[model samples]
Target: MNDHDNNLPAVPEGDEPVPNPGLPPHHWRPTDVDPKAEKRAERQVAAFFGVATVALLGFFVSYFAFQVGDNWDTIAGLGASNLMLGLTLAIAFLCIGIGLIHWARKLMTDQEIVELRHPAASSEEDRSTSVGLVLQGVDDSGIGRRPLVRNSLLGALGLVGLAPIIMLRDLGPLPGDKLLHTIWKPGMRVVRDVVGTPIHVSDLEIGDLVNAEPAAIFELDDEGHHVVEGVELQIAKSKGAVILLRMEPGEITPWKGRENWSVEGIVCFSKICTHVGCPISLNERTKHHLLCPCHQSTFDLADNGKVIFGPAARHLPQLPIEVDDEGYLVAQSDFTEPVGPSFWERDKT
Candidate 1:
């Protein structure tokens, strides 16, 4: 570490700047020597752009083929939609960059030139010279002579620009008050999720947890077909899902003015987590704690759905429930507060 001398020779300082060292010797690429090699390089660059085009097409296919939740396939715990979209978009952009770099290094002008330093501001003559140099550079690029590379680049760029424009359809006319409310309303019966069978308070036993959804989700048309289908059905189910849990009445601590919210010992809370909206029902019966498998957020079902532990910042939303005239458990009204993770207009409600 101490082998080098600490003191070094110092040169005299002057007002005049150091003389220019000049440019290094230019090295010609293989593409510059043989016409066959030049043609091969050109084709290679175009092939990269071609691959980019194919990747963009695959992105579009993945967008349409794979629905977000129920219809999506999975790869290593990641949804195929997410995986394909990210992979394709990354490849598209990467290929474009590689193609441009390869074109510059192998085909574009390689001569070395040195320019003396000049004032920051340019005169009219200097500006004209700069414009001429830019035009000369374009000519030296051979873009006009090589129609294959030029057209391929233009096509790839056009598709790249078109991809985002296609996705702009997701920005709707606006959500209005749609997201502020769910399918749940006063007197709406709480039913099991997939089977859509109405649940009675007597059906639940102590320490039982049942996944449920709003009865409106099963409304039949004149032909006995479900009225809520496709994307609308998915949205309604996501926003209206709840869990019916039965614990000892004495074990529950009702929040202010919420004493009548539960039917006997059966209390209802939104299944969606407050942290990031993952469905949560991993129950600890002894402590009445509901844990989210996604992020380990925990909530206490016996105490107004309070966040008892983990990453959840807010309590799980409680759904007020009462027994119907027919002995079925039904909602008293829509949730007093919006459920699920926080959103931009969540506080507005």
Candidate 2:
């Protein structure tokens, strides 16, 4: 009935007319309109990539320069080694991201395109054409022809691979015979951890649990002692730490061949969980259950640290204990069997 109705496209009696909105005006970028600006942008992107290469090289240098245990006070509580390593590696990744963005915005072709709707499945001809387009893009990247860019990218990637290799240091040296031994020895006094004082039977009470370690494990001889320092100390302590729990004498049920392993009602078991080597000490005195916080593996302290519940595949290894003439508790000997989680080499024979 009006100019608007006359201009609108014809529609079916009950169908709605489609709305029309023209595309927005295009605005050309500085690099797109100027050749010199384009070249400058390309160089700026390349410079960013160059800086990224240097940062990656610095990452490798920091990896080897700083020891894991070095003092951290040098950088406002951040270790010098960690600070440099993190900064260099972070810059390396950040530069690459920024460089790629700059290259896309300034150097790569930018044009608006409109594609009509098509079926989800592509025709064989369309597929072949798409493959050709991908190949053409790869060729345009000049990765094979530009030795400087190609080599730098390759070198950066190679340095990145070193991160996982360096982390492998945490897996540690093959445990070997180390897992089979500890600081425990004949007549070595059992001492409370931290305070390093020898434990007497009188120091414990019924329903009491005390976390203890071998006195010799923490002792320094006149010329200083051997074993249990650095990585070795951490590994040894992980497998050697024990919990001493005292129950009512009538409540104790000793394992066979372990009748004399306890001093009075005081019994000792590995603090390391049997499930996956978590240091377990949570005690339920009324139930005689020692719970591992990691996986909730429960062991019965009254019944030789046997796995009573949860995912533990084996029992907590028990240490033999006795009172010496000096009235302090001491190990009769080192653990008769391996402690902590079971290993592939464990009990193989």
Candidate 3:
């Protein structure tokens, strides 16, 4: 009826005509209209990719340059190895993301397109059309024509994948027989933990539990320095730890061939729980039960360290003991079986 309505497309009888609003006017960007601006933008995107490449190189350098706990490798109160690896890797990933964004925004094809709606289901024609569109998209991305940006992006991604592969070397050279044996050997004197004082049978009372370790832990060399120190000392102490419990001699139910393993009424067993290798010391003196605090795995020291309750599948390993000439308790031999939690090769023998 009015001037605006007159421009509308004609419709069938008795049907209302729908107004059509066309797309907005197109505005050309600086890079789209000018050659120099396009070149500058391309350089900027390439520079971002270059920075990403440099950051990735730095990541490799940092990975091998510093050890985890080096005394001199501290930065901002954090370990230099961790700090540099995190910082460099973060910068490399950030730069790669930014470079891709800049490339898409500044250099990729800029246009407004309208596509007619079609059926949701696919057919032979739709599949062919989709393949054509994918090829067109690849061409529009200009990756083939932009060698500088493409190569740098490919290099960064390749390096990122390679970094993880290099770290797989730390998985191990295999523990071999290390877990099968410990620092405890024949005639190793059982001393009180922490204080490192030798223990005599008279020093213990009935129903008493004392945490003890092997005497090799406190042995001094000719220079007066501990023979077992550093990481070796820590590993030895962990695997060689035991608890000496004194109960009435008649109360103990010794297993076959273990009647002489205890001295008088005191018995020794590995402190590590067999379920998950947690250190256990909570003792129920009334019942002679040793309870692991971590998961409630209980062991009865009076009955040859039998598993009385909880999730422990195996009984605690006992250390055969006898009194030395000086009355100090000593191990007759190392543990007959391996101590600690279950492992893959544990049941092989």
**Worst lDDT 10-window in candidate 1:** 1-10
What does candidate 2's lDDT look like per residue over 43-74, in tens digits? 77667678877887787777667667544334
**Count of backbone collisions in candidate 3:** 0
TM-score of 2: 0.56
User: What is candidate 2's CA lDDT for residue 9?
Assistant: 54
Q: How many collisions per candidate? A: 0, 0, 0
lDDT of 3 by residue, 1-349 (tens): 8545779656668553444456799989998899898889888877877887788788788878887643648788888877888888898888888989988988888898865556799899999999998999888988889888788788888888887886785687667788887778778899999888999999999999999999885555688856778898878988989999999999999988999999999999999999999999999988999999999999999998899899988899999999999999999998988899878777622
Q: Return the top candidate by lDDT.
A: 1
For 212-255, candidate 1 gives per-residue lDDT tens digits of 99987456568796677789888888799999999999988999
lDDT of each: 0.88, 0.79, 0.87
Compute the lDDT of residue 291 as modeled in candidate 2.
98
List candidate 2 stretches off by more than 4 Å. Answer: 1-7, 10-51, 66-87, 90-114, 117-132, 144-148, 161-183, 191-218, 221-267, 276-309, 336-338, 341-349
Which stretch of 10 consecutive residues in model 3 shows the poorest summed lDDT? 14-23
